[model samples]
Target: MKKDLWIGGEYRSAASYNELKNPYNLELLAKIGSASQEDVRLAISAAHQAKTMMVEMPAFERAEILEKVARFLRDDLDECARLIAMEAAKPLKAARAEVNRTIMTYTFAAHEARRIHGETVPMDAAPGGQGSLAFTVREPLGVIAAITPFNFPMNLVAHKVGPAIAAGNSVVLKPASQTPLSAYRIAEYFHTAGLPAGALNIVTGSGSKIGEVLKKDDRIKMITFTGSPEVGRYIREHSGLKRVTLELGSNSAVVVDEGVQLNKVIPRIVNGAFAYQGQVCISIQRIFVHESIIDEFTEQFVSETRKLKAGNPLEEDTDISAMITRGDVERTKQWVDEAINNGADLRLGGSAEEGIFQPTVLVNVPLNEKVSCEEVFAPVVHINSFRDFSEAIDLVNDSKYGLQAGIFTNDIHKALQAAKKLEVGGVMINEIPTFRVDQMPYGGVKMSGMGREGIKYAVEEMTELKLISFKTE
Candidate 1:
């Protein structure tokens, strides 16, 4: 199958296309048109041209269009989920779940479109004078560049594009090369939903080539990206005077208290660690169990991990699937080998065949090792025991990335205290850090990322506030 580029509300072909192979079996799935520098320029120009109409369109119209998009997505739920599973190697079950979340995300955006409210300033209350009226109104930023990642391609793209459109702004999207089909399908939805031409244009190609154009383009007012810290920093440094919202990397940690029920929490921990083969940025990478319950937790955790069925993603019974690529599996194995070489105990599976890497659990991994300290972005986790709650909080905070952390404790005081003390964007009490709903504020701090990504929060990021005042005589 061949997929063309969607530029300025039209599907067109390019000189060359990038082959999109199924990561699980390396089968050819489709070919996406490779966007050239000129194509990138044209997309930006088209968005700029359409910005006036988009910004002037009534909020109600935008909301209505988004509602239509949501209905279409729901109608095509199965097909969308299957596409995600095929392109990204996400399990069919997990992919279906993502489709549901994406639908919720768009639905939330539809609601947020009408709720872009600004506050009224009490100019008269101040020492100024009477008869002075002041208020603020939210306005759309002209052209937003949305660069999305391969993981959660449909939803993450919605997190950016949905809000941009809802806020009455035009978007130029650059989806991940590895999985651009989902993005294309989304653009098609926008087109069929009567979204104005150039309101949503998609360019697919090399990241460096397309990203440089997006960064340098003067027409792009804001860039919302979800990817690595390296690329996020580069975008920040190069995109002078342009607004940016980055959702980057993380080495998320989860703490289990002594009083917690092992049966209740172990399954959640297992899901958090190995879901989507642990490709998630906030997938639990470190587990700090109280020393009193460490042995039991480890035994139960290994037993649960052993039951995961890793095989073809299309199979509904498959609990695990291949990683995005064989290379990622190799890189993950390298990290596991390094941890073992540095005295970490390999308690369970540590082998890779092709793109499939068995879910791995490690114990006694030194704090400084890459597997413990860095964003592994794989299906491997390190388990450690902490005698003191303060010590567990310290271990969680020691990493440079402060995305999210989870604490499973029966004690309310301890949960609240950890909530206050953990240096992260979010702290989940009695829930895994991986817990996230579609409408909640989701982002990170430090190297993890900047800005929030819940539908409402993202709409705020995609727009600006303009204060308008009238002085009555």
Candidate 2:
């Protein structure tokens, strides 16, 4: 199959092509048209030109169009999921779940369109302003440069594109090189839904080249990116006061208390730690278990991790699929070996076959080890026991990356305290740190990047506010 670059509402083939492959079996999936430097500049120009038309579009009409896009996605959910599974090597079930979430994301954007409201300011209340009336309105930023990552390609794209459209901004999307198929299909959906030409354009090519273009271009009003912290920092430095929403990496943690039933919490933790091979930003990597129940928790956790089947991603029953690449698998193995050499106990699988790294568990991991300190973005978890509740919270906050954290406890006081005290963006009580819905205020603190990404919040980030004042006698 050949997927073309979408620009100015027209699909055109590229002179250079980048062939996409299945991460699991190295099967050629599609030849993706690679956007040249000229093509990227054209996309940016098109988006800038189309900004007025998009902003002039009525909220109701935008809502209707996005709702149609959601319906189109629902009708083609199976095909979308299959594309995600093949290119990204996500398990079929997980891919379908991502499609479902993307549907909800667009649907939520549709709702947010009607509710993009602003507030009235009481300028008359100030001294010498008795007859002055002022109000603020939220208006769209002109052109948005949306750069998405490979993991959760469709949904993450929706999180950026949908909200940008809902807020009446034009977008030039650059999907991850590893999984542009899903992003291409989404562009087709928008085109089919009667979205105006150039409202949404997709440019696929080298991240360095394309990202540099997007960053340096003055016409792009905002750059919304989801990837590494290093790349996010680069964008920030070069963007020159342009708005940016960056959802970066993390080494998320979870606190398992003494009283919780190991049976119920074990499965959730296992799923959280290993789902999609733990490529997710908020995957539970650092687990601080209470010392009193550490032995029992480790035993149950390892047992559950061992039961996950590592096989072909297309298989319905497969729990653990191949990593994005052999290099990723090797890197994960190296981290595990380093941690083990530093005296961490390897409780479960650590070896890799082909490109598959079996879900691994480690215990007694030092806080300073690579697996404990760095973002081990693999199907791996490190469990360390904490003797006191304050110490558990301290251990969770010990990391430089504070995206999200979780706590398992029946005590309301403890749960509330964790919510207030955890040095992260969100604290999930009785749930894993990986828990996220499409419409929540989701972002992180510290090195987890800046701004938020829920439908409404993202809309706010994609727009600016203007205040109009009326001076009456």
Give lDDT for model 1. Answer: 0.93
Predictions in order: lDDT:
0.93, 0.92
Candidate 1: pairs in clash: none
lDDT of 1 by residue, 355-444 (tens): 899999999899999998889999999899999999999999999999999999999999989989999999999999999998999999
Q: What would the TM-score be for candidate 1 when compared with the true structure?
A: 0.99
How close is every model to the real structure, measured as TM-score? Answer: 0.99, 0.99
lDDT by residue (133-168, candidate 2, tens digit) is 888899999999999999999999999999999999
RMSD to the hidden true structure, all candidates: 0.8, 1.0
lDDT of 1 at 281: 83
Mark the regions of model 1 whose C-alpha exceeds 4 Å error after superposition.
none
Model 2, clash count? 0
For candidate 1, which ten residues in a row score worst on lDDT? 124-133
